[model samples]
Target: MHKPLLVPEFLDRARTHYGDSEAVIATTGERFTYDELGERADRFSAALQERGIEKGDRVAVLDPNTHYHLEAAYGIMQTGAIHTPLNYRLTPDDFAYILSDADVDAIYADYEYAENIEAVRDDVPTETFITNDVDAVEGEWESFDAVLEDAGTEYDRPEMDEDEIITINYTSGTTGDPKGVCRTHRGETIHAYLTVAHQEISDDDVYLWTLPMFHANGWGHIFAVTGIGATHVCTRGIDAAEIFETVREEHVSYMCGAPTVLNMLVDYYIEHEPETTGDAPVRLATAGSAPPEATIRTVEDEFGWYLKHVYGATETGPLITTSDAGRLFEADSDDRFRIKKRQGLAFLGTEIRVVDEDGNDIPRDDETLGEVVVRGNQIMEKYWGKPDATEEAFTDRIEGYYHTGDLATIDEHGMIAIQDRKKDIIISGGENISSIELEDTLFDHPEVSDVAVIPAPSEKWGETPKAFVVPTSGDPDEPGVSEEDLVAFTRDNLAGYKTVHRIEFVAELPTTATGKVQKYELREEEWEDEDQMVGQG
Candidate 1:
């Protein structure tokens, strides 16, 4: 039997088998079972079709982690339209650029973020603007709820090919304008299975929405959790108190976050002394940078939650590796913490290799750094509407591998540890220095809360490592650790050449919506005036 692997089939299965189970708990004080949720999704799909939206049309969604986002995703997929999710953290101009770039036909935005789209509405090609706010349907906008109310709970299902592009996810655009990454039904379906396998999701699990839904489709949790009929507890934003309260109130068993969110929860636990023990210990998957060892210890030891560190980019199903300590090492092993700190082994149905410039695999010595390339069904199909960029990303690097542009090393266990971004590597005195290593070491300091490391121009070393430190007290000028103290501290741990030569105290590090430190932003400022910012050595 040759069945098409469409994403909407996951929802169909949930509706058929788990109809009576609670499917969603919206932060807006509404709850729905799988049957009710599926009916709403079908109404949304019917509404889109009635409004003249056809198959392959682009439908953009701009909202926080809400049930509306979830419904819109399934509805769009059911209608055979490409689901495009915009980052709520982006500026109005950025939204404008992406809307035009993707040729978006319709958009479903939350009332909180509709103004951003309103600002750029006149400049884009969108034909329909739908807002979730039913009370205040002003101007040309239509109420999302009203549309669903007037529509039926059934729509004609179009014949879909597994290779059809179902979603277009935009990159963070740290270097330049964001590129839209194309994902087919087959790729995302494979990724959803992998997510369930890696995260150990089950029907009994209750998932909290700490991660944004717009970020790689919430790292494919929407499908993984829904496909298994797991409960989805939606949150409007990431708030420490609310998260703690929800975890206790709703018995949240599984969630995902970046390191920054983890740090916030740990800090909150330290200051407020929240109850750590629960009915079932929480399982959190964290990525978007290698979290400091201190964070892992605090999360597991103090908060009584298991932390799994995973790694990937928006291009590679956004999850290619995971460091599940319990599976990789003994509970009492001394090297457990050290091993968990590294990005773990390749995920199921994925192949990861660390290679040099010539595309040859590097030795598994854990010392030699190389670019991380991946080949699997989970990889994105291509860059949308950018042939040259797509070709540059996949060709001339490896025959079938996608270059991640992330430098890493593999240990004897075939576990990969990221060193640094290729452009972020500091070549000082003919020695390569990893900024992530320096930041990880600095995070061990008692007074340091957050840190970013960038290469600065130096007459002696051509380019030297500069540390930007955010203190625990949240004051830049009054940082408890002085420059001399930090310098001596680094000298005690790292090599002389890799030690940070300059320290700049800051209130907070600039981060993306997902909480990754924007090192390129800091690097540009430090090297703005230099004729050649890169090291000549």
Candidate 2:
């Protein structure tokens, strides 16, 4: 018997294997089972077909994490239409560019974002529009519910190959314009398998959707949860009280989030009473950053939650690696905390290597830094339209390997530690400095909530380290951290050059749509003028 690689097969297996299992529970308080979800997904497919949506048509969905959004993902896949999930926070102009770039034929948007869609309606190639909130619909958009109600249940799924496009994920381009990262059926299915294996999730686990759906298909949990028949609890926005309440009331067993979300939960647990049960403790998976050692300690000690750190980009299905295995440090709390800090080794069927510009493998000495490269089934096929961009990204330095553009060092145990972004490394006075190391140390301070390190001009040393910090409590204009005090604090922890020469407390640091700090923006502001550079040198 041949195996099916399509996404609908996964849904069919769930309905056949665990038909009555609870598939999803909406934040607005609606319960749905696997069988019900499958039926709804099929109904959505039929509705789209009735509107003349054929195979390979681009369909965009703009909404928060909800049951309808999940249904739309599967329904679009069932019809062989590419699912394009849009970030609701993006400006109308950004949305218009993506819509026109992808040549989307139809769009299903929430009531809150209908106006934005209408603003760029004439620019995009959209022929059909469906609004989720019927009462909130304006300017002649069709009702989503009415469309489904009018369409019959009979529908046929298009024949699709494993390499066919399933999703077009737009990555926030820091250097230039945003490009669409196209995901194929084979890539998505392989990544879901990798995630399930690395996370060790089972059918009994109750998954909480803390990460947004628009983010790499919730880091590909949308398929992993369905693959394992896990129950999903969807939350719109990150609210500490709401997250705590849902975890307690629903007894959530597994969830995923960025380090920012984990930091918030740690603060909540410290400030308020935490909910617990005699059953198993919740497992929290975090990525986007390595997470400060303090946040890792708090999650493990105070909340009694097992924290796993994963690392990946939108182009890699966002499930490249996870830190879960226990070493000798498993017995020692301090030692284990340090182990959790590493991005950890690769999952089964994935190979990771740190190589120099010459394409030679670097030693696992834990000190020599090199560009991290990978070869796996989880990597995306290519960027949607720009072939030159895809070629440049994939063929960066070493030949035939996907250059991650992340500088990393591998330890003796084969665990990878991210030094900094390839462009984030600061070269000051002929010495290569890791800004991430400085940022991690500053995060230890009690008053600091967020911190980013960038190079500042220096007359004597060529370039010096500057710290841009965000105070957790005080106003940025007058943060509690004085420049002198912070300098002294760093001098005690780090070396001479590593010590921060200047400090500025800002309201907040710039971040990408997926919550990664935009250090290049800070670099541009600091080194924007030619006269300033001449004077500093």
lDDT of 1 by residue, 1-537 (tens): 987788998998899899999999997899999998999999999999988888899999998989999999999999999999999989999999999999999999998888888888899999889999945544578888888999988798788999999999999998799999999999999999999998999998999999889999999998999999999999998899888988888899999988888888877887898876457679999998889989888888778788888999999998999888476688766567687788889999899999998889999999999999998898999998999888877865677788898999999888999998888899987889999999999999998888888899989888999999988878998998798888888989988878887999998888887888888889888888888787521
Full-model lDDT, candidate 1: 0.89
lDDT of each: 0.89, 0.83
Residue 163, candidate 2: Cα error in Å is 1.5
- What is the per-residue lDDT of model 2 for residues 161-189, given as tens digits with 9 covering 90 to 100? 99888999998766677789999998899
- TM-scores of the candidates are 0.97, 0.95
Candidate 1 worst ten-residue window by lDDT? 134-143
Model 2 ranges with Cα > 4 A deviation:
276-279, 530-537
The alpha-carbon RMSD values of the candidates against the true structure, listed in the order shown, are: 1.5, 2.3
